[model samples]
Target: MNKIRNGSTVVLLVAVSTIMAIFIACGGETIREVEVVKIVEKEVPVEVIKEVPVDKVVKEVVTEYITETVTETVIEIEEVEVIKEVPKPVQVEIEKLVIVTPTPGPKVEETWVPTGTFVGVSNETYTMSGYAPDCVYCATMVHLGVQESLFGTKRGDAGELVLDPWAVSSWETASDFSYTDFKARENVPFHRGFGDMDANDIVWYFNSINPLTNPDSRNDTGGQMGGTLLETSVVDDSTARFHWDAFAGHTLFKTFTDLEEGMGIFSKKAYDERGEDWIKDNMIGTGPFQLVEWIEAERVEMDAVTNHWRKTPYVNRVEILFVPENATRRAMLETTQAYAGNLPIKDWQSMFDMGFGLAPESIYTVTQIAMSGNYWEYSHIKTGDTLERVRDISKPHVGDPYEGGGTTFDGNTPSMQQSLKVRQALSRTIDRETINDVILGGLGEEHHLGYVWNNDPIWQENADAWSLPYDPDGGKALLTEAGYPDGFDIEWYVGTGDYETQQAVAADWLSKLDVNVTFDRQDYSSWRPTIVARTNSDIFGGCCWGPLLWPFEWTSNTSSFPGGYGIGMELPQSKASFNIKNGSQDQAELKAAAVDMLQYLNDWALFPGVVQQPNAAMYNPDMISWQEMRPYLWMRLGGMRSFEYIQLK
Candidate 1:
């Protein structure tokens, strides 16, 4: 019984010990798998190996050893450390900055050589290359601004400015005559009565008046005077006109007088009026000097009218002699024939050798082809012929010249300008760029067919699409479709006065296409007739005109292009209204196409542009104070001769 009991206790002890060992092993492995862990082995409790203390004896021993046992029960412990590798973070940086703005650039600069002190007319505005351009043009510069000097502080103050006005028969008949509305009148000639309103005596130059009484009634002799006085009358017998000197093709002279003496001159009316006389012997304008003498093409002598006006014009006596040629002027300058005069372009180079004051301004003009009601119509040649056929047709239609009347068109005629496809074909066939480079010295730009300039907002902004590239292939296709697959003959008419280079350009352009073009240069009279006949039918080739801003001013069959295009038919087509309304070129879907075929060219083409011609004034060094000023923009009151600033060496 004792052995069995002993065996049972042993079994129980072994079982308990095995269970504790398993628990310890499981806990340690779990920690190691998930973390950096450490395992330590120490002794198990001593009581497990020893027998239990007796109740009475244990109590007595506990009391005796309690103090000592309690003191030694505490154990010492040390900490374990673990380390693992992980990723680090990153860093960054930055940069510097700056800013800028925009502004206008400077104008072009030029250098010139002069033979003498620059002594040319100072005028700037006459329809040419300046800030402010004009509608009219003249041979010589209109004013003295070309010399780059100010006659006074005021602009357009032509206070006896030296001008080269042509010897004209009458202002009313000739466009060459320069006249302003002095008589405060509408469509009336300027009046310069022989009277003094201001301090000085008013001696005015007058343009002829409109026909009120018969020209024969312009008799100053009145009742008596006959014989020598009647015989010397300007027109037949006598004259009541005030501008006798200018009218007589000579200088005029007069003094102020309240009462009428022989035949007193009349005053002129203001602008926009029926015609009122407003002339005074002496007048005050914004000028430093006043006209002391009224010399026609002779010398415009001015006296010191004001403080500043009298300061310069430094030379004591100023005289202007009319000699148009450059060689003559240069020769005079070289030999020092005159104190001041215009010099040749070559002689300008020699002036640098002597060291004299000089200044030069570009005095070029804008070439405008002014188109009027006179032109050919659709009734002329139909759109299906060769160049020869048209030339032959153009033969008999030439009109008379401008000197008189001889070339009036017959009531029955047709127009050749009616076909847009033909014109487009012509445009494509010609290489305008090549012409400009070769003939115009690369100074001109290639142009399209239009009314306004592409750069001008007035024409361009208002225009529709049309200014596309010259598509020769497209033109050819169009020509073929228009029943001219074989092309037709055209007599490209040339005028007598035309520049030779332009003729070459036209020939070259025609050569590119399938046509036989011929040239026939005629005199002014014959040319005039040809123009009228051509407008009436296919008598002459195309006419190239001067620079004009609006395309319509130069291109239309009647005059000027209206920005868009339309098909012109002898009879109206059913599609006319629909195409015009529904085919809004500005619409989104067709905007690009319209822009190319219509608007662009109508405002930027050859018919209207190249407004300013390339012209420059040759000058020497001493004339230092010259700031290129725009004549149109600057000249508000008068013509181009007015100037505000100038410096002389």
Candidate 2:
């Protein structure tokens, strides 16, 4: 082996000279490499399509149709070289054997060709025939492409887009046409634009985006409702797809998006001209049902999307009529009056056993507390001379493991979180294992600070210091040192109907420390104004995480937030959170550091972590299959056995 003797050799030679002169030496790590899988990027479905039947070609179960686009942030990794040399190739003699296997050919069935018919407003412009309230969230499911502008509607309602409204407005005016002009055009003929379809064929919307185009104004960037609510569609014929709006998540989706977009967007959503509660109460959505009635926190009725492309859906439509009594919704599903939906966890099993379908979808959200200084950089703050340290005091050496589940947060504020002593004390006081096993009945999963599963590569490479260890003694010492010798009451914030196991365990453990919390919120909207909007306190508590992008979300407590030295780190920080939209990775280091710190806190219980809650749904074998799916507002129900796809059979 030969060593390079140039720029790379300076430190080595200096080290040798120093060692010889004073008998001084140090240790170093041998760089180990990781093996990688070759990803053969092969281009890798649901719903009923009007196709030739397997036997005859005529069973056209055309329910009518629709429309579709995407922005995927590219994740490219730079490979690192290891010091160890790779083994040279080894060769061996080959042996030949006679083949006993036969080439099997085919069991063939009659073919059925599927097709889609386009519906809703076609043409390049915003096409609307009759007047109907539009639900942005539900509108995203279409296979067609559409463009709406910022000037037409405001954020006070969930009608605007994700991009800048002013930017959108400027472009629209430049086009010499407003959304109204585009809306005036004649609707175009439907065509299965998305390409290749079937019943039970799963079609997806671009997370609040639709494919309906306004070619006349396609170049106009002034503005359009680029996201949130979406339009839905289905395969109509070999050449057509039907469309409508799937109305479920728009209300909440817009609320969260506004929060994520920062104060400006939040302000638009709340106090803006249209106003926040307007969207909340008006409850506009484009689904099989329309909000025909609302009684203020009471009930809602819906009518089917008219001329919804083809034969209408089954069930004669739906109604989430006010049933304040939790028991009412449960009874409705159990008795088959409401059809199907998710019920509270308490009623989950009973409904399942009784044969009602469980909404097998991603539902449970988590909240966890964690530290920032697990790494040398952030740890220095916690180990500093000043009373405030970055690392939690209880178990300074606790290893933070990554690749798992759950998120880490410092309540919702930093000043309250800006102290390591308090965070560390809280971390040590609770027992994660007990909570995981007993409280959660192991129903949920534990993750590294960023809520990444232990299987994730990031957790493997970086967060070795965040895995939690149960140690009340370690926690007590931290609390006592933090001036909470007798323990103090800290309010815990969470969503309603979150994991009960976590709350119970937290109460049990903190109670032992003479520390207690009253309760937490079940929904972000209820808790957001005070915790985030008001942004006044440091002692905020709650959890939120999802996808590979939790670090991308600002509210997450992980130091991974690129904006500021995360509150948990106890570093000098800004009083407010930073906005990092446009999917920017500019602050990646800060994000990585944030993740490191968050996980580090987890290892020592810096934040109380609950279990990972997968969006779950239960369905009767006789009715539907509750298969698992990606975390989002998506579910499949279009096969022949599907309710919408139902037949006399």
Candidate 3:
């Protein structure tokens, strides 16, 4: 400490007070440091001093203020950043492991191998050889694809009927319906190394089958085409023209295009060189198959022609086995000896339950009773000449106009009225519904008239009038009114096929009316000739017909003409209706005529239909697959119609 003087300067020291600066930052945030620098001056209190200078004491007192030096303190603030730390993830590698299993091989015994041979079992093939056109069983050759026809019928995709040119390329009909010219397809090779077919071959075929050219010809085609076909002339190498007296509507399709009626075209050179005897057992035609061997009733073997122009058979060879017994046929199918077989209607369900496929509904034929010896036509229609007609009035169902001198309903003879009542009684006694269920296994429809299917518009419209009710009492009363109070004896000509069973069913039903029925069993080969010649005196109990591409009225309805199974007899009203169907071009007029014809046929009750039978068969689905097969719908009486469409798995 220094003493204070009046004229001296004073130096002072001071204690400093410091102020601290604080910084705040949120979590995970960066902080900025703030540096504080300050310089401050502070005032200090000083004591009063009296000063006495040298050599003199001053009487006067004086007060003076003194200035002081003070030291300053500096506070500096530095900015520092604070950052939150984050941890990094770590990755580790590990070894991989795998597991394996073994597989077993298949055994050879479990595999199936194709034998390359397909067998089809049928009830019968009467003539293994298609020797002549007149042969009733010869038409099957054309259906089997061993021969070819000039024209053929098929069902279109929409199930409508379609007539196609088979061997011929194209055809042109005369505007007056008098002639038709056809151009044969080129490069059509005949089977068995025979020369190719041409216009000359076609001319020769027609001439050979016609009675006018060959007087010895006994073919039924002579009666169908004798009066209509005048001649066939060759125009060029592949063109031929047919001259006709009058080519009516559907005449070509119904006669020439029909599988049953159409004659399979043959090679002229083969006939000229091989002779009749040699050609009888051999077939020379343009088809997709070639005949290998025929063992009569045993079997018919044929080999497929590879890469055929039309269609090639899927199997290398086909064997059609004739198994007469239905049980044997079924057994053959079950044992896999036969891939397909014709089975009875009753066995169809059991076979189907065993995974067998049934025949498609489209391929079916109608079975009925066609009364023979009912010839009522007094004159020939084609010649318009008085004819010597046979009227066997001894049969109760037969009518004789010669006795009463009239032939129409307005002036019907007594015999005609009596025959009508008797036939009606026979028809009424049949329980068609029961027969359809029991005999046909409910797979058939109960039909009332021939050539009139249940689906036909005419049949649908006239179902009530056309249908004959099943009334045993009414039948008895009708028989009593017809002067047959005691039932008479009648013979039913039976044949091999489903018709045999159908006739049996009908005869059993007829027995309820006190009618004594007798059976005249015969093979179709012997029975067909008499019917074709219109000489059969007994009623054929089983008559089968099919759906034609067009309405056919000339076959059974024609007067003194060879036609279908029912052609054994002819009627006057039916003959008149035949003319209408042949002459009229309008569909409406033809349908009207058909309705009238069917009505007359129904009222006469001569040809009473029993059931619309399906040409059904059984097949093993696992062994054979017809998945994409479109069968030929016009196969009448059913054989292997579309056998070419079969495929083996």
List model 2 lDDT by residue over 1-649, tens digit each.
1011111000000000000101011112222232221111100000000100011111111111111111212212111111111221111121221212222233343232222211110001111111012221222212111111111211212211212221011111111111110011112111112221121111121111222332121111101222212322333321112121211111112222211111110111112344433533443222222334422223223333333322233333333332324465556545545444444334543454566553322333344543333321222211233231223223322222211211232332322332455565565555555454443334445543534433334455554565555567777776667566776654443333223444554565465566665444333223333321122132323333222222222323322222121323222221012122212222343244445544544543444544443323333444433332211212111111112222111
lDDT of 3 by residue, 1-649 (tens): 0011111101111111111111011112233344322311111111110010111111211122122222222212111111111111111111221211122233233122223677888865444333454444445667667777787655444333335566776666665656788878667888867778899899888776665566555553455564467778899988888887655534555456633345678888888887876776676667767777765446677777766656777777778876768888889999999988777666766776689975432244566677777776777766767656667878898877667555443327788789889888888887787666666666667877766666544566689989978888999899999999887877766554434444544465455666766665455545666765666767664332322223343445455353433456767776776666555544446556766777777877877877765454567888887643223323432345556667776
Model 2: how far is 233 from its true place, Å? 28
Superior candidate under TM-score, 2 versus 3: 3
- In angstroms, give how far residue 309 of model 3 lies from its true place: 2.5
- Summed over model 3, clashes come to 5
TM-score of each: 0.35, 0.45, 0.76
Write one digit per residue (lDDT tens) for candidate 1, span 1-649: 0000001000000000001111111111122222111211111000000001111111000001011111111111111111111111101111211111122133233222111222333211111111111101111122322111111111123211111111111112112212111111111111222222211111121112111112222121111111001111132111112221111110110011100011222222222122222112122222223334322223233332222311232222222333434556556545555323434222332554565323222222222221122232222222222212121222222211111222332323222232334445555555555444444444444544332233322334443443445466775675565456666655443332223333543454344545444444432222333232233233232322111211111222321111111111111111122122121212222223323333423421223222222233333334434443222111111111222233334
For model 1, what is the alpha-carbon lDDT of residue 421?
Answer: 46
- Sequence-dependent TM-score of model 1: 0.35
* CA shift of 598, model 2, Å: 4.2
Q: Show the colliding residue pairs in model 3.
A: 33-79, 33-80, 35-77, 35-78, 36-77
RMSD of each: 46.3, 22.2, 49.4
| Global lDDT of each candidate | 0.25, 0.28, 0.58
